[model samples]
Target: MLYVKIHQLSERKFKITQIAKELKISRPTVYKYLGMTYEEVKQLLEDPHRKARKLDPYRDWIIAWLEEYPHLSAAQIRDWLLERYPDMEVGESTVRSYVRELREIYQIEKKNIVRQYEAVPEQPMGKQLQVDWGETKQKTINKKEVKLYFIAFVLAHSRLKYMEWQNRPFTTRDAIRCHENAFQYYGGRTEEIVYDQDHLITVSENAGQLLLTTEFQSYVNERKFKIHLCRKADPESKGMIENVVKYIKGNFADSRVFSNIDDWNKRALQWLERTGNYHVHQTTKKRPAEVFLVEKQHLKPVSSLLSFESNHEQSITRNVGKDNTVRFKSNRYSVPLGTYNSATDNQVYIKIKTGKRQTLEIRKQLEGEIIAEHLISLEKGKLIQNRNHTRDRSKGIEEYKEHLISRFKDQEQGRTYLNEICLKYARYRRDQLAIIHRVIQEDPGWIDEALTKCLKEKLYSANDFRDMVQYFKNLKVAPVRNKMNDSKGPKHAKGMIVTTRSLDAYTSILGGAAQ
Candidate 1:
C-alpha cells in the first residue's frame, strides 16, 4: 500500500514533500518507499522472521482474549497479564503496541454495544416529574478545578427543567430545600415525583416499600406528592431528567469558569433563559419554555414551602476542629471553647440564615442552641471570628478549682492534685477541671480516696483520677436496695391482696408457742 501510494502520487506530479506531509510520514521514508517496487516492498516488509517483542510470548493469549471480549482495551490486557503472572515485567506502551498489532493482524475489531432504549409514552401535564443529580469539575476564576454537585428537575410532559448547584454534596435537608425551590420555580408541583433511589431521600427499599429519610419523608407528606423511586441500575425510568442533567453539564456548565456560587447560579439562570429552556429540544422539536406555558395551567398549586426545622434556614452539619472552629467556604469561623469533644464526635449544626447578607448561626448538635454567629465572609482562607468566642473561658480556672476543692473532704489535698494537673497539662487544664468537677458531682465520697492514690502514685492526669475514682467506687459495697412495695405502685394494679384475720390465724396456730 505504501509503494502504491508513493508511485501514484509521483505519477500525479505531486512533490515528495507533499506526499510525506499528506501521509504524515517523514520525507526520507517516503523517498525510500518510492524507490522500491510493490513485490520488493512486500518481500522486505512482510519478512516471516521479525524481531520478537517483549509481549510476543503472550501473543496467543492476547489474541484469544481480544477475540472473546472484543471491547477489551490494551490497558486491560496489561492489567490481566500482571494479575495472572506476578513476576512478569512489561511496560504499558509495549502491551498497547502488541495488542494493536494483534488486533490488526487477526482482524479482531473492537465492538461497542450501545444500550437500547425505547421511548416511553409522555404523561399528561403535571402528572409526573423526574428528578436526578449530576456533578462536574470546572475551572474557577483562578484556573483551579472545583467540583460542583447539582440536582436536576424536569417536567415529564413539557421537558421544562430546573436545577440548583452547590459546592457540597446534597444532604436530605438540602434535597428538601431544592425541592421547594423547584416547586416555586415551576409555579406548581406534580402529582408524583420520580427519583433514582438516591440516599439523600430514600434510605432503603424493602419488599416494594420505599423508606425515605426522616426529613425527606416529612417534606413529601407536607408537599402531598407521591414518590416513584426507580430501581437500582435503572436510570432509564427517569430518562427525561437524566437527559436534562446531561444537557446542563454539556451546554450550561461546560467550559464556564466559575466564580462565586451566587455568580455561577446567576450565569446559569441566564443560560437557561437564552439556551436551555429557550432553544428547541431535539426530540420534542419545540422550546421547553413554550411548552411550559400550557403545562403550567394544569400543575397543582404549590403549597407553602417546608420549614426545615427553621423558616428558610438552611442547616448543615460540620465537624468542629480541635481549635474550636468550623470551616465553611474555605473560611473558619470560631465556636466557643469546649465545643470540640473528642470522646464523642465533634459535629456541629451550621444554620445559614436566608437574607441578602447571610449570617451563619453555629449551633450545638444535641441542643440545637446557637453557640456562635457571624456574618458570612466572601473571601477565602479567612478567620471570621467573634471576639467574644475567643475569650479565655479558662480565665475562671482558679475559682472553679477552689469550688471543686471545697467539695473534697481534704481541700488542701484537692488543691495540690489540681495544681499538679495544671502544671503538667497547662493547655488541658480546663478539660481536666471539667472531668474532675463531673466526678465530684457523681460521688464526692471517692474523691479523697482517688486523690490520695493519684498523689501517692504521681498520676497527675484527670483521666487517671476519674479511673481511680471509678475503681474506688466499685470497691465500696453497694447499699441494700429494698424491693418495691405494691401499695405504692400504680393504682390500677392489686396491692398484695392479703386476706383479713391473718394475725389472728397465726396466733391461734401458734397458741402453744405464743409465750
Candidate 2:
C-alpha cells in the first residue's frame, strides 16, 4: 500500500517533498498517505532512522536459542552466531534489532491465534454471577496455624464484587453457604452462576460435559439458579472475578495483619466498601457500585432460605448375639439385658454429619421404642468396643465355697475351695474370689448361664459376658405368633401362604434373618 511505503520512507529519513517528487504527487497527498502532519514530517526528518529492520534468515535460529535460554545476552548471542559462521560477523546492535523483530512477530502470531476464539457477549445485568476462591494465611487467637479461604463473587455485567474469608477448609457445605451469603448480601438472585471447576460443586467431566455434585445440584435447584462451569484452565472466561482477586490481594491483603479470620474478613469488607465500590473501572468508566445499582434492578427477587443440610444418611445394623450384646460396625456396644428384640436388630440408624470434619451421631430404637442413649465414639476409623461385654474366666470348680464359708465362718474346707476358685478364675488373686461372693449375693443362677455362655463363645473377659447379658435383657423372649393359622397345614396351602412360607424357609436356610 502507498501508506506502507510512506511510513517506510519516513523511517528511512526521506523528506516529504523528496518523497512527493519521487512518487510524482503533491506534498499534501504525500502527507495524507503518510498519516502525518507537516510539523510531524519536519520532526521525523530531523530524527534518526526509525525503520524496522528486514528479517534475517538466521533470525529464527537466534529466536529459538534465546527462547530456550532467555538469560542469554546480546554479546553471548553474537559469539554463538560467529561460532556457527566463522566468516560472518554480526554486530550486537543488529542482533538486538533482529531479536526485537522476532519478538514482535511472535506477539502478532499469538494475537492472531487468540482472535480465533469468539467471546460470548454479556446479556442483561445480574443474569449471571462469577465465583472463585483465593487463599492466604493468618495467626489464630491461640497463635496456631490458620489457612484462610476467601470466597470471591462478582456480577457478570457490572463487575461488582464481594469477598469473605473463612478458616474452615472448603467443602460442599461451605460452597452452599457462600452462595447463600452472597445472595443475601446482594438482596437478589441471578438466574445463573458462572464458576471455575471447583471439585466441591462439579465432580467430573466426560466429553466436555460437567457432572454436578449431588449436594451442589440440590442446593442450586432449591434456589432456582442455573450453574455454568467455565472450561478448565480458562481464567479469562471469568475475567471479572479474576481481576477482583488481583485487586483484593494487592489492595486489601498485602499489608494487612489480623488476629483471626473473622477480623481479617471484617477489614476486607471495609476495604471493599471504601475502595472497590467507589473506584471507576478503567474499561467501563463507571463506579462498580453505580453499575451494580443498575444491574440489581434486573435481578430476580431473592428466594426464601432453604435448609441446607448435607445428605449423607446411612442405616447401621447392630449385630446382637444370643447373649444380648450388640456389635456396632466392628466394636461391641451393650444395651440393657432383654431390651433388644431380634426382630428389630436392624432398626438402629446412625446419622453421620460431614462438615469441616466428620462427626457420627447414633440413634437406637427397638420396635420404635427408645431404650438407650450413648455418646458416639470418637475413635478415628477404629470401632469402639463395649466395656460391658468383659467376662472373668478364672473361676474354677469351687463355685460357692466363699458363700458357704461366709455362712460357716470356721469352715476350713469351704475356705480352701473358695481360695482355689479365686486362684483359677482371678489369676490367683484372692480379691477375685469376692466377685463370686458378690454374684452369689445378687443371683447365683446367673453365674452358670453367664459362665457357660462365655466359655461356649470363647469370650476373653468378664466384660464380654456382661455385654451378652445386657443384649438378652433388651431382646424380646416371646415367640412371634403366626397371624394366619393354616387349618389344613400345608397339604393345600396356596398363593400368599405358600409364598410366605417359601420366603421364610429360604431366609432361615440361608441364615438371612431380618431385623
Candidate 3:
C-alpha cells in the first residue's frame, strides 16, 4: 500500500522527501519504490533480499555486475569480485555459491515467481487491471456444441469488468484486439495490466528471462503499457478476472439461449450494463459503473494512445476483377463501377485484412478513400456484393430495346409482336425481350396468330413461350392430296389452322369402318 502511494506520488512529480512526509514514511523507502514499475515492485515483494548468506556483504555488488553482463561466466564474475575486494576474506567455494545464487536471482531483470496468493489489499482506483480468457461449449443457431471463448478484463480497484467473446481460440492479434476494446470500454486504460503468461504473448523463457513473442513485443512497444505476468498454473495471481469469468458463465450465459452470435453479443453488452455494472459490488460496496466514474479520473486518458486497434497491419493486396469486385483471400467484395473495369485500363488495388468474423473495408490505394465495406465470409467462392454498387436499371431494358427495334424494323409483324410481349410482360421486360430475340432468330412467324391467341390466357415465362412455339411447329396439317402437281391441296388452299383435342366430342371408329 505504501509502495503504491509512493509510486503514485512520484508519477505526480512529487519529491521523495515530500512523498515521505505526506505518507509518513521515510525518504529512503519512498525513493525505493518511486521509479519502479508495477511488475518490478511485484517481483521485489515476491523475492526480497532477506536471506542472510556467507557472502551477503558482496551480494549486491556481485548481483549488479552479473545483471549488467549476463553473458559473463561464473569464473569471470568471481575474478571481477576479487579485484574489487582484494582485502575481502570470501573463499572460492563461498564465492561460487553466491555467484550461482546471483545468476538465479538478479541475472534476469524480471522473474516469474510461483507462490500461493494471499488476501490482497484493495488497490486505488485505476491502478491495475487483470486480464484472462475463459472457454465453454455453447450451442448457437446453426452450430451445435461450439467452443466459445471470451476474454475478461477486470479492474482491481473498482471491481469493474469488461468481457468480449470469440468463436475460436485467440491469436496474438485477436488478444490485442480484445485489449483495444477493453480499454475503449473502460474509457481509458489502467497504468498496469496483469496476465497469466499467455502463450500468445510469452514465447518461452531463456535462462529464466521471460521472452515475449515477436508480434506481442511489437504491440507492447507501440502501446507502451506495463505488463505483469503471473506464475505458471497460478490463477490466484489474477483472482479477480478469474472470478469474473466464472460469474459471466454462471449468471449470464448459463441459462441464456443464443439466437445468433450478433444478437448474443448485443445481449451480453446489455447484461454487462444492467447487471454487471449497475449492481453494487460485493467488495467495493458500490456500483461498478459509479465507481468507474471516480476511477476514470485517475486513469490514463485513452487519447494518449491510438484510438483504433493496434494489430491491423497484416494486410494483403488484391486487384479488382471484371465484375467490379476485388477477390481477397477466396471471397470477392464489391467496389464502385469506375473503380475497376476495361474503360479506365487502370487497376484498383484493395488492401484486405483477413479474419473470421471480420469487417472488410475497401480503401483506394492512392487516396485511402473507402470505396466499399462488407462483412468477410469464411466460405470460399462467395461474392459479397452490395446492390447499391450497380443501381442503374435503365441501362438494361431501355437501351437494349432500341437496338432490337432497329435490327428488325423491316419485319413489321415481328416488331409488333415484340412491342406486344414487352407491354404484356412489362414487369419481366428483360426476360420477355430476351425470349423475343430467341423467337425472332429461331422462327420469325412462330409467334404469329398463336401469340395473339395466347395473350388472352396471360402466360409469362420465357420457357413457356418457347414450348408454345415448339407445340405450334409440331401441329402440321395433313395434305388432302399427295399428288406430284398438288398445288391446290386442302391445307394449302385455306392455310393450316391448329385445333386442341376435344376429348369428349371426338368421334373415333373402333376398327375404321364402325363410324
Candidate 4:
C-alpha cells in the first residue's frame, strides 16, 4: 500500500521530498522504492506473510487474456474488469503495475507483425527510382477530419526522397505533373523507374505484357525513362520506397494538423531536409543528401518542360456498352448508334479535358474518328445522350404504317384510323404504329374488337387501343379462373382471395377474452 501510494503521489506532480513527508518515510526510502521496477516490487509483495493484493482473484483470467491476445494493454484489461465486476474497486495505476508484473513472470512477451525481407543489392547511382502512394486522415482548423493523399518518390541508390500532397485523389494527369516535379527536384531523372502496378500508370498487366495508361505512356515516351512495374501484392520488389512511405507517415504526418495541401507540402520539404535526408540510413550508415550529391552527377539531364496546352487532355480507353455508351466518372455518355458491335472489338478512347467546365471527346480506337462528344456531367449515375445518335425514326415510318394497316380486318377503316393517328400525333406516329403492330402480334382477333371500340368511342391513340384489346383479352381468360374457384364462397374475387368472418364469431371471441 505504501509503495503504491508513493508512486501515485509522485505521479500527481508530488516531489520526492513531498512524497516522503506525506508517506511518513525518509527521502532515501522514497528514492529506493521509486527506483525499483514493477517486477521487483511484485517480488516484495510475493513474500508468504505479505497481504493479498486487490487483483489477486482475477490474476488467472488476466493471464489467459494476455496469453491468447498477446496484445492486450493494461488499460484494456482494467476496462474489462470494470465491465465484468462492477462492484470491484481498483485504480488504473495499480492495474497497470499488476499487469506488467504478470507479463514479466509468465515470459509472455508482446509480439509485432514483422515482414520477411531479403537484402536487395543496391543499384548503381542514377540507375532507378521507386514510387509509391500513401494517405492519412488529418484534422482541419475546425477540428473536422479530412483525408489527404500523397505520392512518394525515392532514388534507389541514394535513398533521397520527394513527395507531393493533394486534397483529392490523383488522376493520371496529376501523376504526370508529380513526375515532372520529382525530376526537377532531383535535378535530373534516373535511367529507369520502379513502381507498383498503380492504375494511374498502368491499365492492365496481361501475361506480363504491361498496358500503360495513355497519359502516363505519353509522359514516359517524352522523358525516355525505362519502367519496372512491380508485380501485384509484392511489396518486396519496392520495399525501400515502402519504408519511406511508412517513415513519412509515422515520423512526420502522424500528429501534424493539416491546414491546406500547399502548406502541408511546404512543411514536408522542410522535414525532408532537416531530418529525413540528414539522418544516417540504417543500412548504409550514410546520409541520403550526402550520397545524392554523387548520384546527381550520374543522372540524365532533364529536358525542358513539355507544353501543357498541347497535352492538356488525358485519353483513357473504355469498352463501349451494349447501349452504345461509355462510363466516365460514374456517368455514361452516348456514342453513335452501332458503336457497340459485339462481333468486333468495342473499345473507344475518351479524351477528358480538364478546365472550368470539363468536356470529353470520344473517338473510335481503331479509326481515331471523333464518334461522340459531350460536356462532362457533375451528377452521378446519369446517362448523357445526344438525340442525333438515336436511330432515325423518319426513315421507313410511312411504309411500316401501311404494313400495320394491312393486318387489320378492314383496310379502309384501318387507313382511316391510322391517318387519324398520324394527324393527331405527328411526332409520335412511329411509336403509335409500333404499339399497334405489337397488339396485332399478341392477338389478331382482339385488334378487330379494339379497332371497333376505338372508332365508336373516339379513342384515337394507340395506347387506348392497346388497353381496350387487353380488356377484351382479360375477359376471354376470366372464365377459366372463374371455373377453378367455382366451389369456393362468394367472397372470393377474381385475382385475390379474402376470408370473410361473421360478426357473431367475433362477438363470441371477445366474450371469451372478457371471461
Candidate 5:
C-alpha cells in the first residue's frame, strides 16, 4: 500500500527513504517496490507460490478442528495430533508453520489480531449518558475484605462521569436512587440514558426493540428521560462507561484502605470533585466540571422532573393526618379511623396496584389488615376526605371526649387543647384521643408538654405526638416515623405480613413458668 501511494505521486520521483518516512513503512519494503505501479504490485501479491510443508497431509483435518474450535492454539493442535495417532508424529515447528498457512487461507488471523474500531460518533450536548456497573473483589474495608459493586455514568459528549460504590449488589430501588443522585451531582440529566443488558433494568431485547423491567420503566417514565439499551453482547456500544469503570477501579478504589460503604461514597464524591471532574480528561483534554457548566444548561434540571413516586406507581408508608386521612396521590384519602386511630400501631402501609387506569382501586393488603379503600384521584394535592368515613368515628369521638374532659378538663390549657382537637379532628376526634392515650402509655410526664406543643402547632396525629416525645428526649428534632425508631422503614411491604410477639410471653418462658 505504501509503495502504491508513493508510486501514484504524479511526476514526482519520491526517494525510497521519503516513501518510507511518509508511510511509516520500512525503507527496504519501499525500495522493493519503488518503481512498481499499483497493478504490478497487485499481480505480485496474487502470484501465490507457497512452499510445501511436512504437515500438509494432515492440513485438512487440522482445518476441520480449527473450524470447530477457532480458539485452538497451534501447540494444542500439535499435541492432539500426536496423542490421537501414535503412528503419525509431527514436530511442533511443522505444525506451527502449517497453522500459519491455514490462518491465511481461512482468514482466521482476524480473530487473533486485536481489532481497531472506529470511535463512536460524538453526540450533541446533553444527548446521551452511558451507565454500567463494575465489581471490586478482595477490597479490604474496616479490617475486613468485602466485595464492592459500583455503577458508573458517563456523559457521552463531555466525558463527565458519576461513580457510586456500594458494598452490596444494587436492587431496583438502589439503582433508581443512584441515578437520582447522579443527576443531582451533574446538576441535570441527559436526554437519553444508555445501559448495558443489566438484569435489574432489562427484561430482554427482541430484534432491536428494548424491553425494560417494569420498575425501571416506571423510573424512566417519571423522569421523562429516554432509555437506550446497548446492543446485546456489544460492549463497544457502551465502551465509554466501561472505560470509566476501569478508570474508577484503578484511580480511586485501588490501593486504598476502604472504609464502610458510606465513608467510601463520601470519599469518592470528594475525590470526584477534587480530581476526577476538575482535572483534565485524557480524551476530551478538557476539565469535566468546567465543560459540565456549559453542558449543564442543555441538560434537564431535576426540579422540573416529576417521576415515578409522583406520577407513576408508588408504595409508601405514610402517617395518616388527624382527619381520618392517609395521604396518597398528593391528596387526603380516607382510611378507617381504626387504622389511623390505633394507640399501639397507628402506622399503615399503602400499595398502589394496576396503575395507569381510570378508577384504579387502592385495595387493602389483607396481610397488613388494612380495612379501607379509595378511588384513585386524578387531581393532586386536594383534600379528598370521604364524609361517611368520618361519620363512624362520631360516636367514638364523643365518648372519648367525655372521658378525657373528666380527667384533664380541670387544667385550663389542657381543656383548650382537647376542645381544639375535637373541632379540628371532628369525626376523627377519637383518633386524636388515641394519640393522647399513647402519650400517656409511653411517657405520661411528656403528655402535657407534647399535647401543648401539638395543639399550638395544630398537629393532630399520633406521629406528631411521637415526634414531640423524640424531640424532647433527644433535644434534637427528628422525623416522627424515622426508620431507626420504627420497626419498618419508609418502604411499604408487599406480600409480607408483620407479626409481633409480646414481651410477657418471653418472660414466662425465661422464668420456666407456665402461662
Candidate 6:
C-alpha cells in the first residue's frame, strides 16, 4: 500500500519508514517504491515519446529502393545509400533489420506479397518422397578435370537420403535412370514421388499447375507409382531433398577428392549411411536410419520392371548410288544392278533405334518389302564399299591383270589380250583402264574376238572397240551363188533373188550353211 501511495505521489523524496507508517503497509512494499529515482519516473512518463533509435537513418529510402529491386542484398543497399548520402553511415545489420520489418508488415496486410516459403506437412512413412538434382565440384576419371551434378532423393518423414553422381548433361534418360536407381538404393519405392517442376521431367511449363512429362509419366504408370509435381521455382516444396543436397555438399563433397564419378558417388552413399542416416536429427532427436526402418514396412516392394530399357523408335531409308551403289557415311553399299533405275520416283525413309549404343540400320523398302540392309560406321573419310557387287580397281595394271586372270582362268590367251588393251587405255585415262579391266573380268571370251576385230578395222581408241562390237552384231552375209554371180557377171544381177522350191533343196542349203 505504501508502494502504491509512493507511485501516486510522483516524487522520490519520501523515506521508506515514513511511507510505510503513513500507508500502514509492509516495509518491503515501501522499499520497492523508494528504489526508483525522479529521473526513472520522468523516463517512464516519456517512454512513448522516446523516439525509437533510428536503426538506419536512411531506412525509408532503402525500403523504397528495395521495393524497386527486391533482389538487392543488405550490403548492396548500404553501399548505395553511402554513395547517395556521403554522411549517412549504415551497417548491413541495420539494413537487414529494416528490410525484415518491411517484410513482416507487408506480409501482414498484403496476401499476395512474396514471402519466405514454409513446407507443407508431409505424410507419414511411404506416402511421399522428394527428388531433386544437387551439384558438387568433383575430379573426373582421368583426374584432369573437375565436374558437377549429383541427383539426390530423400524420404519426407525419415529424411533418409539416396544420391548418385550425374556428371553429364541432364536429359529424360538421365531422369528416368536416376529415379530407378534411387528406388533400388532405398530398397523400396514410395507411393508417390514429389518433384519440383524441372524441364527434364516435366518437359513443358505447367501454367502454374502440376504436369508430368509423357515419358516420365509412362515410366511412373508402369510401376504403379503416383507422380506429384510441385509449383514452379519452389524448391522448398521438396525441402528434404534440397536440404540433403546442401548437407552432402558441405559435409562430404567439399573436401573430398574422388578419382572418378563412380568413386565420388560411392563416397557419397557411404557418408549418407554413416554421417547422415546414423546421426540424430536436430528436431526429432531420432536416428534417420532407425526412422527409415519403420517407414520401410509401408513402402511398396520393388516392381519387376528393371531400369535401362530402350526407348527409341526405328526408321529406314534407301541410299541412292553416286554411280551404281548406295553411299552412306562415305561407304558404298551396293544394290542389285538396276534397282535405282526403277526407283526414281520413290523417297527412301531411314530408321533409327536408341539404346546404350546408337545403331543406324539402313534398308531399302520397295512395295513394303525390305530389299537391302547395311550398317553405318562413324570413321571419317573411310569408304565402305559393298564387296558383293563391285571391286576396287584403284591399284593399277599388275593388280588389275592378276584380278582378270583369276576370274578368267578358262581363257588365259583372251585375258592377256584384254590386259594389253586395258594398259593401252591406261596411258590416256587410268579410270578408263579400270572400266576396261572390269569388262574383261565380266566376259573373258569377248576379249580375243574384240581385239582381232579391232586390229582388222585399224581401231586405236577405246571408243573404236565399242563401235566394232556394234558393227559385228549387225554384219550380214550374202548367199554364195549370189556372191559368185556378182563376181562373174555385172552389178545388175545383184537385184535377182533365188528361193528353194523343195524341202530337199532347202535341207542341202542348211547343211552347207551349217558346215
Number of the predicted model whose TM-score against the real structure is largest? 4
Backbone clash pairs for candidate 6 read: 315-350, 315-351, 315-352, 316-349, 316-350, 316-351, 317-349, 317-350, 331-384
Better of 2 and 6 by TM-score: 2
Maximum-lDDT candidate: 4
> How many times do residue backbones clash in model 2?
32
Poorest stretch of ten by lDDT in candidate 1: 490-499
The CA lDDT at 159 in model 3 is: 86
Write the residue-wise lDDT of candidate 3 on 107-177 in tens digits.
24222334444567788887899988888776666655677788888899888888888776787667877
Instruction: State how far residue 480 of model 2 sits from its true place (Å).
Output: 39
lDDT of 6 by residue, 240-286 (tens): 77777776775566534567667667766666765667667765679
Residue-wise C-alpha lDDT for candidate 1, range 234-331, written one tens digit per residue: 77787788778877875567555789888877767766775578657878899999999999998999767455456325567677898889999999
State residue 343's C-alpha deviation in candidate 3, in Å.
56
Candidate scoring better on TM-score of 1 and 2? 1
Model 4 stretches with alpha carbons more than 4 Å out: 1-31, 34-113, 307-309, 313-360, 364-367, 375-383, 386-515
Indicate whether candidate 1 or candidate 3 has the larger lDDT.
Answer: 1
TM-score of 1: 0.45
Q: In candidate 1, which residue ranges exceed 4 Å CA deviation?
A: 1-116, 305-308, 311-515
Q: Which residue pairs clash in candidate 3?
A: none
Window of ten residues with lowest summed lDDT in model 3: 340-349
Q: Specify the poorest-scoring 10-residue window by lDDT in model 4.
A: 477-486
Order of all candidates by TM-score, from best down to worst?
4, 1, 2, 6, 5, 3
Worst lDDT 10-window in candidate 2: 107-116
Clashing pairs in 5: 222-307
lDDT of candidate model 1 versus the reference: 0.77
- The candidate, 1 or 5, that scores higher on TM-score is 1
- What is the C-alpha local distance difference test score of each model? 0.77, 0.59, 0.66, 0.79, 0.67, 0.59
Tell me the tens digit of each residue's lDDT in model 4 across 320-351. Answer: 89887998999999986655643334557788
Task: Give per-residue lDDT, candidate 4, residue 348.
Answer: 71
* Per-candidate alpha-carbon RMSD to the true structure: 17.7, 22.4, 25.6, 26.3, 24.6, 25.6
Per-candidate clashes, comma-separated: 0, 32, 0, 0, 1, 9
RMSD of 6: 25.6
